[model samples]
Target chain A: MNKTINPLSRQIFIMAFSLLMVYPVLWWLGASLKSNAEMSSPNIFSKNPVWSNYIDGWFAVPNYSFTHFYLNTFTLIGGVLFTTIISCSLAAFAFARLDFPLRKFWFAILLVTLMLPGQVLTVPQYVLYNWFGWINTYLPFYVPHALGSGAGGSFFIFMLVQFMRGIPKELDDSARMDGCSWFRIYWYIMMPLTKPALVTVGIFCFLWNWDDFFGQLLYINSVDKYTINLALKLFIDTQSAMPWGQMLAMSLLSVVPAVIIFFFAQKHFVEGISAGALKG
Target chain B: MNSDITSSSTTIALSRKPKRWESPLAGYLFLMPWIVGILVLVAYPMVMSFYYSLTNYTILDTPEWVGFQNYSEILFEDDTFRQSLKVTLLFVLFAVPFKLLFALVVAMLLNKEIRGLSFYRTMIYFPSLIGGSIAISILWKNIFGKEGFINQLIGIFGFEGKSWINSPDTALATLILLVVWQFGSSMVIFLAGLKQIPLDLYEAASVDGADWFVKFRKITLPMLSPIILFNLVMQTITAFQMFTQAFIITKGGPINSTYVYVMYLYELGFARFQMGYASALAWILLLIIAIATALVFLSSRQWVFYENEGGK
Candidate 1:
């Protein structure tokens, strides 16, 4: 029954379908180089490309450039990455290894939070953050992640916990016999061994926090503090007849970091996702 | 001196007393941040959110208590709420199944022992990595705009195309298409699950002269049900909370055809500063998600095959 389509035909079919899947993205690349006049034309790319789109769009936002937004984004991502790695790995280690009171209960809660919609907490969390005077600052972003409750923070911990469980218990016992403390075992032994999972968590933390437009839009209101996402959204709101070519140019730039990371660390991402699904 | 040191170490080992790190307090110590997080960030806010739902708390004034008023008005009187709910439900219903179906089909095709497998996987999965950014949403808007690439392409074929995003009939469809476009991550998960199914099972089926469809039905589907359930729940919850594309691409526009639940909630809470009403909406959203998830789980017992449960 399967021989209806030979292997050679199947390969051709997959190749064609893959091209169709990424067709829009390819168009996006070509369109970003097109002059505004060329936008309506059916040609993917213009002969004389307008390179000014990226340069102009970079400084299009008044008083603040893309540089400022990129800085804000990197700063936010850096802090979130650090905090998520430290906090989530600790929580995962504790859950996976430690025998504490109510461990199962808390672990179950972590699993529940993995599926809970973030919208439920938005209104009151806004109020709470407002009360703390954190509405216009990055503290709201930082504090939750530091405490292992940010977006996908629970899932990160859950993933790490699954990874840590696969590690033999004897390693911990051997370290303990050498007068190593639990913290030491986690820091010295478990962290190094769970490097793959930690890298996965870091990559996810960076990507999710970067793409979190809603949270950034809600919190960082001022121009100077705007992230790349907020800046992009602002670019649209401010421009009545938006420079399509310029807008496309900047949008392409905006996704570059994520694309680069995905390509560079593609293996970890695939493994991380597979592990999270199968093991969890 | 060496013998003296050895004897002391032996004594220490013989005692085998629990180290300070072995104590239960260490566990709490490790969990302290998350504990504080759940209380301050999750638990307290959830309770306060419920309270705010019952009040007339616009952020400007002190929260005036009007118990159940917000809930009553929303449930009984709101048209936009119902519209948003319908749009959201339709979006989820269409998007999740189509995305999963595409993902599974592609996964099956790529599961073969083919050359350039990684290349195909990478190209297909690339979209999902950056799909959620505002940039992609902006790109989507232009792609479906009046003079966008799609319309232009169709025009060349003598098939007239309208501005898809600006039409009420097609606005939500474009959004669903956007969601369906990023089926890469699900495809990856499905691919992994596909690999885990024992080759021997397929080989045995072949020996019995079973066709591809029979092998797939009796072997692949049962083994992969759990992953299917996982993808279903994740994608459903995600589809329900979809805000960025609707907010940016369509702005919930063309007569609110794309106004999702969260967009409505966002308008009420953030734009109009109706924290109380928005909180009510938020609670209902939570309820909807919970029921939906529970329903999926309940339904899964009938379809999802658990190996540990001793194969039905």
Candidate 2:
């Protein structure tokens, strides 16, 4: 039933919604370029844009540079992506392919962990980290990702397992017929075929680690060791006047890498999130 | 090549049942990293937290056995605890339904064949990716602050606006707005679910002379119920655990009006160094979420429709 609605009205509706969605981002970009004096002015949009705020905010924090924060965040993301890919892929392969004793029980245990809020374990985890001398180090930041420890990582593993289940058992049977060991079958056959799922998992791990604020705040105390998100918090805290321009400039800069990653990995992001939801 | 293949198969046959730990060892090896990580990081800490919840532990000293004192105090004596609970509940109540509704509406709109669909989807989904960061919280504070962009826009309508981030009445509302703005992720999931719904169902309804509203109610709503449940559970959990926005924008400010439960727990554990009490609060939160989720699952039997069940 092609009920002809007015194209003009629908376009207007789309435009209005788009503008409403885009307005905050535009305002943020504008505010990030405005000086403190201009920020205090009645008209936020009318202010002369000072492009140097980005440079100034870059150097504003003492001893701990934005570059350092960027590096730290990148390392965290890299570490997480690397470890999550390895561990989740391996575990997913085992769960999807191997017949083992009490496999369902173990899978059920993993599922139970997903429901338990991370906050419930924060204090004890902090103490454990402190006890292990992992506090103030990047170990606490990246170790969980490496180990498939969080809900995101475990959920990703579960997702990969489901996708792997869809792969034909004939491939495994053929590989076995060709005298390939189980390990070789998983490594050579399954791993390469599951690249899309891996990419999805990798993008998620990277984005999650990059944007993680609470974990960084809890684990990393020193400014020099701070992730980008933690540095952004520090930037907000130390500004005498609301350094709106510099804050915006830094925030915009901070979001650029994630946005770039998101754009490049958009397909995986969509597929992974949807698959995860559907499976759940 | 045949001799090589024969030798490999013979080798596999030779190694198949050599020992109890031979074949499954590789499987266990593959899963070792995650298993060990869970034991050290997840399981151990969880047990420790449960133990700590029954004690009077501070960061500076060893935990002393207190046996339900912390839980009792939080339930009865602490006013801020009560306030935080009320604020968090209010925030969840206000945010979750609106978020789901907004997600469903946007998903419906985007489900149509449109020009620049990818671009529109990107624009919407980008916020959810960005909103999880501290930068978004900073942006939120600036936008909602007195003499900020929101006020500037309000002035265009000849209305003077108060400092939203600093006012008790408006602080929580601003946080709610922030939550609402990040509806993109859920909307994408909903869109995916919408795609799975066969268009022929809608066509059949239209052939029966069903109105748009009637078709939407009878067809779309029932088909979308499972996705709705998924979104609801996830969004509810997120809403309850909201921290970054409140932390950056108001710091649970203006007479603890926006003081969310998690923020209070953070303050108790980190700021005040009350580890035991904080652990207790965490467990309480876990209980609350689990009960709420269980309740939803129980109610889903009544309302949530699975397509394979033939709408039973």
Candidate 3:
């Protein structure tokens, strides 16, 4: 029920909290553009903006090229998105439609993996990767995505399965009656109908792989092989004594791609994350 | 004429008696990639980790089976392990409730019909998207450092502020604040849940002259129980596995006061090359989380409401 309180006061409260949330980000952007001297000054907001820090930060380190880092991150995110979509969709189809023996058991096992912490697996995974000579290579970063190894892949499979279950079984039966193979029904009908789930999975996989830090740190050893997160870490290490302006500049720059992608895929991201919870 | 007759008869037979394994075989083929991947990447590693937990293996050396010695040592002889457990439990205990409450309140506010609702929602969710990033962690370190922005702000209020990141007393607390600030993801989920709730329930309560607080307690909280449980379980898991912030911001320093279990496991596995011991720690963490989750599920019958159950 609507309260007896003044609508004006409610509006004011909302506006104030909104500003509280937005101000830090705006301040971060402002600080990032200011000169080093200005950043250390008493007045944080009054500083004169200097955009050169972004340029200089980009070119600061040798062999730590921001371009290479971007390419590596792009490859990682792309591989994750592609592999997650293909593998999870196929598996989700199996769980959602094609009834086979012991299906419930296998699905339960898959759900169990979702609860296991990444740290519990990290040690053994490191040893295994080293044994396979996969360390210091992109294989460590991308292979899991391709293989549906991490939580993202499992969550995607679960999400897609939930959405797929909502599709009418009569469509599959009709296709079967028309002499269409199971594969044909899945590829032609089910896949197209589940585009929303695919988009949701794709956006999440992109954001997750792009922001992954621990995985990158463990796998990529050389400076030249650094992803954006690793590069940012190295930047911090070398410029520990530098002004906050340059560091904040680089940090803000590092987050721009994620923010941009989030805005572009905002609808799908929210739907994907909340759908399972809502259904449950 | 004879060949055409034979082909027609074969087609009739094929339609009459389909291959028993055909459909399932196709399904298996479709599932092959994920199945193989899970076997090699997930299942194999899990089994191997169980094996490693029983051994005294370093990364460079072959493992020697030692039965339950590693588990016993960790359980009985390790002080650092106990301390890590304490720190982690403290974190989950303090952070989860406050995060859930803050998220719920903000979500309720946003659920109201307001101008620019999407913008407000977007603004709130920004922190969670950037929450675990190294850049944000670094920003936190700077903001909480001595002579940093937070202290400078405190100075205006005539309050002396300590070096939050460096001080053992405040390091973990600062991280908790950081986590609470990033309640955006849970907030979004809560908002979605709030939208699903029928307005008629509140209307009915108001018809009976129920007050706001009474309606909220009787209706809103109960209806939202499932979503609350979802948030609680997920947040609890994430909190236990917390690594990035403690690693980058505090470095688990100032006498290991901020040394979270996962961070210590990382040091053992990668930095110190103590794979066997790290695997033991990992298993312990898994056990802790599993037990905690089990406890939640066990208690859920008391608080969590399922609408379908009333029909049954």
TM-score of chain B of each: 0.92, 0.91, 0.92
TM-score for each predicted model, relative to the true structure: 0.96, 0.94, 0.93
DockQ, per model, reads 0.62, 0.47, 0.48
Q: Least accurate stretch of 10 residues (summed lDDT) in model 1 chain B?
A: B17-26
User: Taking the tens digit of each residue's C-alpha lDDT, what string does model 2 give over A1-280?
Assistant: 5353466666567667877887889888777878777775655464467988989899888886789888888887777778789888988998888866656777887888766679988999899888889988888766777788854877888999999999999999898888898889898999999998988888877777777778878888987778888888887788777677888899899989889989888888888889977877
- Fnat for each predicted structure, in order: 0.78, 0.60, 0.54
**Candidates sorted on TM-score, descending:** 1, 2, 3
Q: Which residue segments of model 1 deviate by more than 4 Å?
A: A1-4, B1-22
Query: Which 10-residue window in model 3 chain A sums to the lowest lDDT?
Result: A39-48
lDDT of 2 by residue, B93-202 (tens): 99999988998988888788788788888888768898878888888888888878888787889999889899888889989989888899999999999999999998
Q: After superposition, how far is residue B17 of candidate 2 from its true place, in Å?
A: 17
Query: Could you list the iRMS of every candidate?
Result: 1.5, 2.4, 2.0
- The residue-by-residue lDDT of candidate 3 on A165-239, one tens digit each, is 999999998999899988788889999999988888888887777767889889899887778889888888887
lDDT of 1 by residue, A1-280 (tens): 5333588989999999999989999999988998878899998888889999989999999998899999999999999899999999989989989987888899999988898899989999998888899988999999999999999999999999999999999999998899999999999999999999999999988889878888998898889899998889999899998799989999999999998899899999999888878988
Task: State candidate 2's DockQ.
Answer: 0.47
Clashing pairs in 3: none
